[model samples]
Target: MIRDLEDEILGCTRCSRLIDYIRKVAIEKKPKYRNYQYWGKPLPGFGDPNAWLLIVGLAPAAHGGNRTGRVFTGDMSGERVYRALYEIGLSSSPKSESRYDLVELKGVYLTNAVKCAPPKNKPNKEEIGSCSYFLKKEIESLPKLKVILTLGRIAFDTTTNILGIDGKFSHMAIYSTNRLTVVASYHPSQQNFVSGRLTWGNWISIFYKIKTLYTSHNA
Candidate 1:
């Protein structure tokens, strides 16, 4: 049933603007990927169905996830995340080059606030709201979900709204109750990493904290 829902997410075109934008990008292939085929549709969340940890990102990178057909795949941000998860014993690989890269998660699930890649990496409020329904269904499908790690303020805010939690956003900010823990972390965008807003040390520290808290919660 969960798999069926994921397929439904992949086919969703509820947001016409998003659909048009994605199609435009698909046609205007990047020079390096001129010969490659793009997925060009809504990306369904990836990882273990019985996951305890849910990592919510802002959205698909126009060229990365949009091209590779996998959330957090074939991108710098993905490199940072998979490496961190690998170090923490949650990921099978430190690199997510493509959807067929054999990358796997042990107890982790990865997804985005918005399923489709929006123009300039920004989705308006209505687009976000339209996509939230899919997110809500995905969250509810994970019966074992105990922790949600939201990357960036957009992801944090969207997740909180879906879960009906009025929580503030800040790096390392944590909201605990309702049988789940929601932790906010800075997004690993190139800008954030290049500007040192989200450093390797800090990113790793957040995952370590998650491991500790999750262990204690489920112990």
Candidate 2:
């Protein structure tokens, strides 16, 4: 079922603007990674089928995920995210350079609110609404999912809307309901890192707290 869902997501063209942008990005190519072929297609969820933790981000990076075909891969944000996951022994590697790389995530699933990369890293309201269907379907498919970790305000807002939950976006904020717990965090984007808003010490701390919550839920 997951594989079928992924295939459907890859073929989606719900948002023409996003579809065109990804195609243009694929053809133009980043100067440094010019030799490589870009994925350019809509990204789907990536991780264990029975994952207990769901990590949601705003969207794929044009040069990172759009190029490598994996959310959070081939980007600076991915570096910090994986590094922190590795610190907590949840990731096989500290870097997510490629989807085909042996960087496995244990007990966690990774996905984005918007499957396609939008220009300037921002997706308009219509685009977000169109992608919400896929997000909802993906979440429903995960039977064991117990918690959602949303990175960035957009992701938090999207998740809340899709799940019909009342919440606010704030770094390290936790919200709970009869369904799943939601933990909000600042995105591990370049701006957050450069501004010292999300340092390694604090970034990894988020995972540690999640680990405890995850274990408790499992128990």
Query: lDDT for each of the candidates?
Result: 0.91, 0.90
Considering every candidate listed, which one attains the maximal lDDT? 1
lDDT of 1 by residue, 73-133 (tens): 9789988999999999999888888887788899999999999999999999999999988
Cα lDDT tens digits for candidate 2, 93-123:
8888887888888878899999999999999
TM-score of each candidate structure, all chains considered together:
0.97, 0.97
Model 1's TM-score against the true structure: 0.97
TM-score of 2: 0.97
The per-residue C-alpha lDDT of model 1 at residue 103 equals 87
